[model samples]
Target: MERMALGTEGIAVSRMCLGAMALGGVQDKETSYAILDRFVELGGNFIDTANCYMFWLPDGTGDESEHLLGSWLADRGGREDLVLATKVGRRPSFPGGGLEASEPLTSERIAASLEESLERLGTDYIDLYWSHRDDRGTELEDTVAGFDAAVKAGKARIVGASNHVAWRVERARQVAAATGAAAYTAMQNRYSYLQPRPGVRLPEGGHVHVEPGDIDYVGNTAGTALLAYSSLLSGAYTNPGKPLPEHYRHPGTDARLEVLDAVAAETGASRNQVVLAWLCGHESPIIPLVGVSSLAQLNEAADGLELRLESEQWQRLTEAA
Candidate 1:
């Protein structure tokens, strides 16, 4: 796959980032290590994880994914060769602190969060640091100033927003432009044919009203990259045997499947390559984060690297989804 830069931050990364969300938790140590090894073996240099990842898992609560990646980096002996990204705030739901989205991300929380992430990842600097979620209660100025502080402190290289709104992201860039603070260089969101389920209105009370292009709607306004997580509906498009499970299937998923099945039948490409290629085909710049559990699966997912689908094919898939 061709490598893409993380916005203007200049951090070069593979178009397909290996998301380590399931690391050290859902998958065992051996399996996680094998997945990492396979990821690198396939020429994937961009790795993503978080301090609170998989904290909701029955087996983890703290930097499990980071610890696993850190350990693997030690074994691989080339931490410098990889571009790593992680987040702070909103860790797994603790008993009283349940991993609920209600938790706030404040400056103090960010500072403490990074220390733990650094310790877990065995790294001195993070290529990209994200807020993970928008802090609706926190002032935009507070968020911008805090990110500026992190860049100045040498703890984080670039700051970005995750699970954020287009207008909020635009205002954040405005905050930076107004005060010369650090601006967001990327956005992380769960965008996929299945996740949003086209035409399906998001649940009313929380983080809703997110329209299409919100990732780039703000990016085009600020010139940042849109980093897509759950890019392939958590790998549902690739499985040919059974339809996606109840929760995994989104409204647009079946439509995308129809096109994918046709493409798979024609080009001899797997359903995943077709779906993933469609993601990369968007008008808004999309860099889908790839998450895997095995070398075989990694290899399978890696087929999307540089696999550019035709315009008609892209349209077919887009229309289906």
Candidate 2:
């Protein structure tokens, strides 16, 4: 697998980042371990998880994903070979509290959360730590300083902003610069080849759609990368049973899907593969954070990374909407 530099941290990661949102929560232990093993065996080195992963599940306690990854790392015995990333700020302070009652990004909470996440993952340091979501109630300076402290203490090599708009991200970077703290070098948001109608809200809570400004910000900024979540729309592109979400059922979707199908036929690949290839070959160069429950899904995504799109086809896909 090809690797790309993550921000200015001097870290190289796989183009496709495996999202471990369901590793130990919804997915059984045997299936989760098998998926993790196959991902590593395929030369994948980037694995992303969060402290609150799958906590909404009926029997979850918000620690299943990280705990499972820790067990896998212990059994596999190759922690240094992979680029591990986890997040804070989205985990609820108490069980059954929900996302509305999630932890704030204050300095003290950041410190405490880092300690807890480290213990859960059974690692001394995190390659990349992310602010899972923006907390408007908290002072921006406090949040920036907290992440900076993590970098300063060597607990996290670099920091990122997830689910934040471009303007807020810029504001946070300004705060970091003024205070001489660590600025965010990476941006993670919900992005896909087929977009929703403008001004429509996503059904999923805490999901911020990537905007045009985000693309420009990442493209113009030096030493920064964009990690796109929901890049495949939860298998909506190819799965007959998984219909497109209500917000994505506009006319633009039909136009885009037509173009996408044409491209898939031209390349003799699955629709999912074409979408992943388009994302990897995007003008700004997006890293698709894919989550899978089975080995077949993982293998399909791996193959998608190997498929390169022609310039014309890429342009057509981009202009379809």
Candidate 3:
């Protein structure tokens, strides 16, 4: 529950952010509540969710995570006590159960996405709003200008991006510099000890899933922080008894797992802890967003904040993985 300044601004939040992507979708409601409650009890005050969260589930599409999180805020008594960040774009799901036509990033899309998110979250303005994913078709000027308009309208206090490369972030930063608008102050992406490449090949004729290397804190500029989601490798580190899911079972992963095991044993910490804590050693600010389905898992991940790996161990794990 230790706090870190989000971006270079006055917005302060917990070092351990509660990620609600799987909430109300993969995780049952009762269990999700227990996990969230435990996160708060442990002093975590940052919650990150998105409008498009969990719409990928076979059960439903869109807004379940936000609605549930908003309900938690209401129950918790003060929404102002927490720093909330949500995103737009990256809608891979459709209302009728098939992939919809790809959406572009522009003012129209931004306004539509924000309205839906605000409606679902039952809030007037978000503490932080993000572009979610880079829109190759949209001009950075247009996107930054749109966000500037939002800031002027008091729709959001700050804006940022997720899953973007260093150059794209720099481009947006430059646009802000030119216009003197509200600039991106944070980044969120799939960063962790596992799979450092960060890219996924574009589907046949579909949008490319390019890895954003700048998504890492050490590579990010000052005044910006990277929220490392998938911090536990989607339960691979936490659930040792279970084999990794089909998608994560790639070549050289076994070697990475072995390295994680060695680090965990040498440090008397869990593999997830090593991965999460190793991120803290990055040259820039790195905060791992812990996603848990149970309070016990939450406790284990929370204890990870105290785990310190030796420089040798960190190097060995990185090299071996």
Candidate 4:
């Protein structure tokens, strides 16, 4: 797979990022390790996870994903070859308290989360650390300064933001610039070839969708890259059993799917690969965070790096959406 710049910084990573959300909970340890091994074998270097990764299970716990990744890293060795990223905030519903009780992005929370993540991952530093979501209650400067402090203290190499809107990202950057703090170099948000309906709302929590204004901002930003989560619409484009997300099942979706199907046939690529190629070949740099539970799914994402779309084909797909 081809390696590309992760953000404005000098950091580089594989074109496609492997998401480990299902590592510990949905998939067993053995299966998760096999997938991770295959991903590394295929030259993937970027792996993303969050501290509060799956809290809804009956066991009522999180960090299972991080623990599994840590185990794999121990077996694999060569930690220098990989780009490790994890997020804080988004308190999962557990026993004592949840997101409703506490605000993330505070200096104390940021520092404490970093320490816990390091302990779980068995790493001293994180390549890219993210504020899982914006804490509207806290001052922007405080959040920026907190991340910068982590970077300065060698806890995290770089900081990023996820589930943030355009204005929030810009404001945070301005704060970082003014205070000489570490600014966000990349944005992780929900984006895909298919667009959600006008009135569609996510089963509400901390999830943030990418808006048109966010696209404009990223297009103009020099060093920032967009790490699009759910870039393949959760495999809706290819899997017959995987229906399109509820928010994305609008009038325009069928049209977009038709073009996607035609292009996939014409290019001799799978629908998943075609959608991924569209994101990679777009005007703005978008590195898709593809969540894979199996080695076959990981292979499909890896193969997508080789499927390039012509300008006309891209235009057709975009217009159809």
Candidate 5:
């Protein structure tokens, strides 16, 4: 796997980050372990999870993924070699409370949540700690200070923002600069090869799609990289049974799909691989967060990273619409 500098903090991460959202939830323990092991074998080190993962599922306590990763670390015994990332601020405050009732990014809550996540992951410090979503209700200074305290206390190495718009992210960074606190060095949002029509609301709660401003911001700014989630759109690119969402079903979608098929055929790769390759080689550059259910899927993603598209081919794909 290729490595890249994550932020100005000197932390290095893999080009492809493993999204462990479904591990040990929809996937069994043995299967999750196998997938994780294979990912490491392929030289991947970055893994992302959150405290509220899979909470919407029946009987989920929202701790399955972290708990499973903790067990894996205990058994595998390599805490220092990997870049572990998990999030907070999105978990409900009490049982039966849905996402709307999530905890605020107060100093007290941030402190408490970090302790719980540390316990669940069996780690002394997290490589990357994310503010799962922007808490507009909380004072931005308070949120920045909370994360700065974590870094100063040696609990988290770096901090990031997820599911936030570009302007808000810039505002938070300004606050951090003024307050002399830690600033967010990474941005994670919903991104993929096919884009939904502009201003169309996504079906998933708390999903913020990446916009052109986001691309320009990350491209122009130093020490910041965009980590894209839902990079493959839940297998819609390759699975016939899974159709594109209504928001993405426009004429542009048809044109992009036609070009996508042509590129995949030319490369002799699966549609999923082509999509992943496109993301990795984009002009602004993106670190794709991929979730896998099996080793086959993991291998295909790994192979996609090695694919280098010709300049014309990449341009054609980019200008398809």
Candidate 6:
């Protein structure tokens, strides 16, 4: 796999980041280990997970993904070779299916959450740490300062934000600068080649989808890495069995699909590969966070690393929708 700068932190990682949201809980331990081994075998090192992953499972247990990675790292004994990333702040599901209280961005909460995450991952320091979502109730200054403290204390090398608005990102950076704290250098949001309809809300709460304006903002801003989740639209771009999401059911979706088909046919690539290639070759520093259940799917995603689209072809894909 090819490498890309994670942000302005002077760190680099594979362009494709494997998301382990389903590891351990939704996916069996044996299968998860196989996936991890295969990913590293293919020269992939960027892995994304969260402390609250798979809490919505029937048992409402969380931390399975991170715990699994911890064991894998222990057995592999090359933790320094990989870029480990995990997030916090979302409310995990409790044992009877109710949501537990979320950890806000207060200093105490951030510090405690980092301790728990480090313990679960079996690592002294994280490569990338994310605030899973914006805690609007808490002051942004406190959040920035807390993350800076993590870096200063050798708990995390760099910090990022997921599910945050562009203005909030800018404001947080500003606060960090003013307070001499570490600012968020990367952002993760719901993004794809196809877009949701105007005024259409997919996640409806703290999880916001990336809009065109967000794309423009990130591209114009320097020193920000944009990592896209849901980059394949949950396989709707490739699998016939998976329908396009409801929020993405816009009038232009058919046109986008047609363009994707044309691009794939022209490049002799799969539709999914073409979508990923588009993300990789975008003007901004964008990375695709892909989640896979099977080794075949993982290989298909990896194939995109070698596929390069022409400028005109990229423009066509961009203008399709």
RMSD of each: 2.9, 0.8, 3.1, 1.6, 0.8, 1.7
Q: Please identify model 1 stretches exceeding 4 Å from their true place.
A: 92-96, 101-103, 198-210, 215-223, 240-254
lDDT of each: 0.74, 0.92, 0.75, 0.85, 0.91, 0.85
TM-score against native, each model: 0.89, 0.98, 0.87, 0.95, 0.98, 0.95
Residue 244 CA error for candidate 6 (Å)? 1.4
Q: Give the TM-score of candidate 1.
A: 0.89
Q: What does candidate 1 score in Cα RMSD to the true structure?
A: 2.9
Task: Please list the residue runs of candidate 3 whose C-alpha ends up more than 4 Å from where it truly belongs after superposition.
Answer: 92-94, 97-102, 196-220, 240-242, 245-255
Compose the digit string of candidate 3's lDDT tens values, residues 1-321. Answer: 567777666888887888888887788778878888888788888888888777667766777898888777677775867778888776653574433444456877887788788877778888889887788788888888888787788888889887777678778989899989989888776667766333445232222222545644335477788777777766876776766655456666778888888888888888878887787766677788778877778898888876777888878876884
lDDT per residue (tens digit) for residues 167-206 in model 2:
9999999999998999998999999998988998888999
Off by over 4 Å in 4: 93-103
Ranking of all candidate structures by their lDDT, best first? 2, 5, 6, 4, 3, 1
Query: Tens digits of per-residue lDDT for model 4 on 15-130?
Result: 99999988988999999999988988999899999888776566746778888888888887848789999998775534555668544678888888889889889889999999
Model 2 is weakest, by summed lDDT over 10 consecutive residues, at 278-287
Residue 149 alpha-carbon offset, candidate 1, angstroms = 0.9
By TM-score, the better pick of 1 and 2 is 2
Candidate 5 TM-score versus the reference: 0.98
lDDT of 1 by residue, 1-321 (tens): 577667666678887889998888788899998888877777888888877776655655656789888888888885876888888756743543444554457777777778888888887888888887777787878878878888889888888887787777778889998998888888777666445544655442222333575744844654577777766655556565655656436656666567678887877787777667777888777778878767877787788655778888777776774
Candidate 5: the clashing residue pairs are none
243 Cα displacement, candidate 4 (Å): 1.8
Candidate with more favorable, higher TM-score: 2 or 6: 2
What lDDT tens digits, residue by residue, belong to model 5 across residues 120-200?
Answer: 999889989999999999999999999999999999999999999999989999999998898998999999989999789
For all candidates, the clash counts are 4, 0, 1, 0, 0, 0
